[model samples]
Target: MTVGPTSSTWTIQTRPPWFFRRVVTNAAAGGSVYLADLVTPRGMTVVVEPAKISFSTVAFNLIVEVDLSGVGRVDDVGIKSDYIGNHGYLSWVELNGTHVVRSPIVLFIASPRT
Candidate 1:
């Protein structure tokens, strides 16, 4: 993480994650959940892994701004991430609240149907 003016303003850089992972909100997301409420957050990223993210929070108004360019957004993404970093962007994905972490895919070996 690199430091910048006034200590608070920093330029943090983290190495891309080694393994490919998926991050997403809960499956029971609906009802009052509004995708329009989702704002491009600031300071951090909205992603799962192998992505670069940044963020900075303001203590006064409790406002967060996010930028996740190139990464793009996928609706109903079945993944999880610890990038919450005190930001509400991830939380906004699901109206029920909180996200779930799971393996992107799983392969099951079985005898071929005959």
Candidate 2:
């Protein structure tokens, strides 16, 4: 599945416990769960890996590792993403590496069956 960011402000919601498990499962299986190809406003596309993913009472935090050193971190912190049927949503996000802190949205659409 594909994921990025969407808008500046996000309305967070609680998700079923199974949701995180599914995401982790997919990632553990060497899938594309954390393959967030975040495109910056400057037209630079960077791939990120989820360093720490955890869901709490009100929202969740996704701390990702960026490939470029000193580029800063990509934090979709205190946000929510959902997986419904074959589609997924990366609703709220923030990239703090740069001073601008652009919000890049990500969509997780399942790949076609081979």
Candidate 3:
């Protein structure tokens, strides 16, 4: 929803790694769901994918940090079920580690109209 910068430090609540895997796989399978309580720092976008689900998916929750570059952070991030389109960013994140990726916020931009 076009989040603006904030002066406070943003801490994203952790979710079960399986949750992320499911979301990513569902997205790849053309399924959609509401991504609740996701968060990231400002000026960054986090992308998740099924194939890239961490090996610790069933063991430990995957937490990756994004450098804010001194900009405000983004937090309480999520993607609505209706948001699904052009997930190229997810693909990019899957191919590269979060360290190389700048954005730390996840979103589904477009979805099929019901």
Best by lDDT: 3
RMSD (CA, Å), each prediction: 18.2, 17.7, 15.8
Give per-residue CA lDDT, model 1, range 1-114, as digits (tens): 111111222223322312322222223322223121332233323443222222232211112233333222221122334232222322233224353221211111122234
Candidate 3, which ten residues in sequence have the lowest lDDT sum? 1-10
lDDT for 61 (candidate 1): 18
Top-scoring candidate (TM-score):
2
Candidate 3 residue-wise lDDT, 1-114, digit = tens: 111231223333232221222212222222222222334433344433322333323223333332222112122234345533221132223232222222234322333467
Residue 14, candidate 1: how far off, in angstroms?
2.6
Which stretches in model 3 have alpha-carbon errors above 4 Å? 1-53, 56-60, 70-114
Total colliding residue pairs, candidate 1: 14
lDDT of 2 by residue, 1-114 (tens): 112332333222312111121122211212122223344322123334563233332223344444321111122221223432211222223222211222333322222343
lDDT at residue 48 of model 3 (Cα atoms): 39
Error of 3 at 90 (Å): 6.6
